[model samples]
Target: MSNKSEALSRRFEAAFMPNYGVPPVALARGEGSRVWDVDGAEYLDLIGGIAVSSLGHAHPALVEAVSRQVATLAHTSNLFLHEPEVLLAERLIGLLGAPARVFLTSSGTEANEAALKLAIKYGKANGRPYVVAAENGFHGRSLGALSLTGKASIRDQFGPFPADVRFVPYGDADALKNAVTAECAAVFLEPTQGEAGVVPPPDGYLRAVREICDTTGALLVTDEIQSAIGRTGHWFAHQHDGVLPDVLTLAKGLGGGLPIGACVGFGDAGTLFAKGDHGSTFGGNPVSAAAALAVLDTIESQGLLEHVKTVGTLLAEGIASVEHPLLKGVRGRGLWLAVVLTAERAARFQTAAQHAGFLVNAVQPDAVRLAPPLVITAEQVTSFVTALPALLDEASHD
Candidate 1:
């Protein structure tokens, strides 16, 4: 490590919370799909801030839009209106292919929180208060959202959480059918289980869930925080499944690295909140909205949706074709993928990759996750494929 980086690391541990541990490298700068540490070492940023930096680092379009908006109108505090927020709402609703109402927040957790409340309110009015969520599903970490998450390891210590929430196995249509009844308020699902290591549901699984929700008169809420915004070669993963949800929540990549989230309610779910039911102080701030608009506009104009499809296939295929013994297989869509290892050595793989001047995340013991920026190229994907065998070797020997 560089002298500057070591000093910064000492200071960071002293000054900041230890929730995420003391990161070994302090990033100094970033551009495109790469970032440099304070020690002047370049590392390919594969995780993209846990899938937040969709446009990659220092994209000219994102910088310009944020700079211009901050200079113009940064905040209206939700007490008033902002043009960028309105435009973004229209764009999202149009992309969603439905008439919906929008509630903007600061992150995916807040989006899920808002959607949960909306479901509860709507359910209460119709004689239902129970919400069904899928097992191993991750919505957020906030109290209300945590209650809806089916991961017991994270949610156990935080309880007593909100009541009347049930969990069914993800991708199991029969389990979901059994759980979401007329007494259920809504069913929350992640189109793809991201933190569970990019686990995708079985074919027609979403269609079955949709039909179950429709039949049981329960709302369907899909959380697309890490899988949306052109990440899965689609605006929303549920769109690829051809399913319409009553509530859809998004964040992560929405603002291209800025803090922004949205809870969009379709049809009756949209208007569930009254004038005073819910709100956020800095939710729809103009600067973040403008950044999001720039992200959307760039994705559309650059034909990145098609690029994601083509390059993502190459990435998945390349990883699967590798002859490393530690390699098991690959899963996920577009730029988001999980490298399934034969052994539970993800932490060692992560450390090896870091030392090799690459950044990836070990979301599970047997799975190393990769959600690189949408701007990543075929060359970058191939480069990672070529380098991964050495990293796996480093892990295997360790």
Candidate 2:
């Protein structure tokens, strides 16, 4: 590492909490699906900052938007209205092609937090106070969001959490139906369990969940923080099953690398949170909202949705053609793909691939999740595929 890099890393460790441990590299800069370490070594940013950089590093549109907005008006409290906030909300609702209202925040956790509060209010209004979530599903780290998350390792440390939260087996309609009672207020789920190694639900699962929610009068809440915004080919992953969620939580790529989150509600559920029920100081700040608008505009103008679907298919097929036993198969849609291995060697493979000039994420011990920017090229996918066997070989030895 350079002197500058070492000094910065040391300062970072000293100043920041130790929850995530040490970061592997001190990044200097990024551009168009690639990032450079402080030492000037470049690597393909395959994970896209955990699926946040939808337009990749430093897209011109995003750069221009943030720059212009910061100069014009960066922030204004919720006491006043802002043009970017209003426009972005309209864009989100229009994108969903459904009647919805939006509540914006600064991060995915906050988005889920708002959704949780909305669920509670909606339930109380309708005489149901219980909430049902799926096993292995991840929401966020805040108290309410953490309570709904089904991962024992994450939730175990924080409890005893709020009561009346239940976990049902994901993709299991029977289990979901059995768990959701008429007293349930909502059913929270991830269309594809991204953190659980990109586990896509079984066919008809989402539609089935929708049916269960309807039958039980429970609001269907889909946390799409990791899967929405063209990451999954469709605008939202739930659309693959022709199902519509009552409440949808989005973040990650919504701001194209800038931090932003949105909780959108449909129908009467949209009005559950009255004026003072929830609010955020920095939610929908003009700068972040402008950044989101630029991302949406570029996604449409550049036809990134079709690009995601096309290049994503190529990447999946190319990886599968590698023909390695430890390599199981690819799951997920659009630019969001996960390479599954037979054993828990994901961290090993991740290190090996990093050395080979690619950045990836070990979402689990047995899987590496790939969420490259929607703008990533076919050539880059081909290069990564070509380098996979060597990465696997090194991982196998480790």
Candidate 3:
């Protein structure tokens, strides 16, 4: 690490909480799919801020929209209405291809919190007190969302979560069917388990879950925080199975890099919350809304959905073709991928990749996640693939 970066890390440790520990590199600036460290060392940004930087860094459209909006009307609290917020909501609903109501939040945790409240309200109204979620699935870290998160490692530390929440094994249709009884208010699922090393469910898992929800009159809620907004070559990952959820929560890439989240409720689920039920102060701040609008507009204008599919396939195929003993396979779809290692060397692999001027996440001990910007090109992917063998060799030695 550079001296400047080391100084910054020391300052960060002293000044801030250690919730995220210390980031390995202190980035100075970013452009497109690359970022520079404080020492002016450039690295290919494959993680893309944990799948939050949809358009990569310093995108022109995002910059102009945010700048213009902040200069004109930066923030108008929920006390009043704004054009950007309304337009963003409309655009989201239109893209969803269904009749839905949108509740905007500042982050994915807030969005899931809102969804939790909606589920609670639905439970109260319908006398269904149970909520089913998949084991090892991640929603968020806030208390409400945390309650819905089925990961024992995180949830065990936070005790006495909301009651009547059942967790079934992920990608198991039979388990979900058995757990989601008629008394279940909602079933929260991630179309692709992002935090679980981008583990995608079985081919007909989502469709079967939808059917089970229909049979039991339970509201299906899909959390697409890390899998939506063209990240998975679709507007929403649930759409891949041609299934629609009654409620969908999104964030991560919604505002490209700005903080924004949405809790969209469909059909009768849309009207569950009446006046004065739930609210947010900076939910739809004009600047963030404008940025999100720009992201949506650019995705459509540039045909980035198709671009993501083509480039993602190339990257995945290239990684799979690498003749490495440590490499097991690749998982997930589109730009959201996880390189499965044969052993618990993902941490070493991440360090090796960083030393080689590439950034990837050790999402699990045996999985290295790559969620590059949706705008990443084939050439950039090719570069990474070409360098993978040596990076793996270094990891093996370490």
Candidate 4:
């Protein structure tokens, strides 16, 4: 059998309940911004594994930290305190520039789940129980998190959701001001809405929401899952406007490709979870925490935040110059970019981009999101931009 087919056969047999479709390419290894398939065909990875590979493949710092910690001590559950977990917490709070409490988990969904529960508990404490979120804002897929997600397709099959959640237009501060009453305990936002096609809010929109929440005494929860941890040229995406969320949900890039997530709570929200209020068995494990610390240290030491902004600007300008009828414009900040195409051409463009030895994603029918690793260079972005006109032409015919 061919090596690729043989590998796929084995994976299909061993795996359980496929959620992501059948495999496309079997990745062998990766370094920097490149990945090679099992057949040894290499491609420039612009999607960055759906924006998870912040430092790209096998970054030396991540390798060293994870290796040392795993060899020394791997999994020590929440039964006791561990150095890696404590150290990571301190670093995260310091970067946020606020007194924050952290609840670590294994993935972004878990972090969102924990955050949703905290909002619920906080609501009960304040004698208010409703939560407010925005249309087209995606939080996560878990039952609790899905309840807050504004996408209808994602939440359609799973009905009978918790009763107290409401949705309004994203970036509509006035709508939020009208929707959130005294009965609402919290409002969740993604500074740049990643999954619903890299939609950045209107200028000063986040600041306005913060003001509205303050006036209403409601917590402002920011889901930084797709835009946080240097993906958007900042420690946190919302920090661009100098706004602090009552609670922040983070993952994707936090562990440098390893599975780790955290819900950071600031001020009074920080102390909401008392002893026995919430816990995760495998949360804050030493190995994952070690990986996160390395990601943070590397970002600071390498000045990757600056690099992201520089390269991302080039990408946006390059995409804008593509000169295709389907190409509308580019949105988002830093490495988190989305190209708006005409009609439902995102899928076609994704296929075309892949065939051209590059990778990106169709976040929606008309928008394609490109969130490459922060490590991607200007030269690589130029190469992708150079190929865009032809790629769009081909995708249009397809």
Winning model by lDDT: 3
Give per-residue lDDT, candidate 2, residue 42. Answer: 94
**True lDDT of residue 288, candidate 1:** 92
Q: Model 3 TM-score?
A: 0.99
TM-score of 2: 0.98
Candidate number of the best TM-score: 3
lDDT of 2 by residue, 1-398 (tens): 67878898899999999998888888989999999998899999999999999999999999999999999998898999989999999999999999989999999999999999988888788889799998999999988899999999989988988747999888999988998988999999999998988999998899899999999899999999999999988888888889999999999999999999999999987888877999999999999999999999999999998999999999999988988867988888888999999989999999999889999999999999999999999999999999999898888884
lDDT of candidate 1 over 1-398, digit per residue (tens): 77898899889989989887898779989999999998789999999999889899999999999999999988999889979999999999998889999999999999999998998898889999799998889999999999988898998998888757888889999988888878998999999999889999999999999899899999999999999999999999998899999999999999999999999999988988999999999898899999999999999999988998999999999999888899999999999899999999999999999998889999999999999999998999888999988988998984
lDDT of 4 by residue, 250-365 (tens): 98899888899999999988888889988898888899899999999989999999999999999999998778798898999999999999878988898888778888898899
Q: Give the range where candidate 3 is weakest over 10 consecutive residues by summed lDDT.
A: 156-165
Residue pairs whose backbone atoms clash in candidate 3: none
Residue 324, model 4, lDDT: 78
Candidate 3 residue 193 C-alpha distance from true site, Å: 0.3
Model 2, position 192: C-alpha lDDT score = 95
Model 4 ranges off by over 4 Å: 1-14
Q: How close is candidate 4 to the true structure, as a TM-score?
A: 0.97
- Give Cα-based local distance difference scores for all models: 0.92, 0.92, 0.94, 0.90
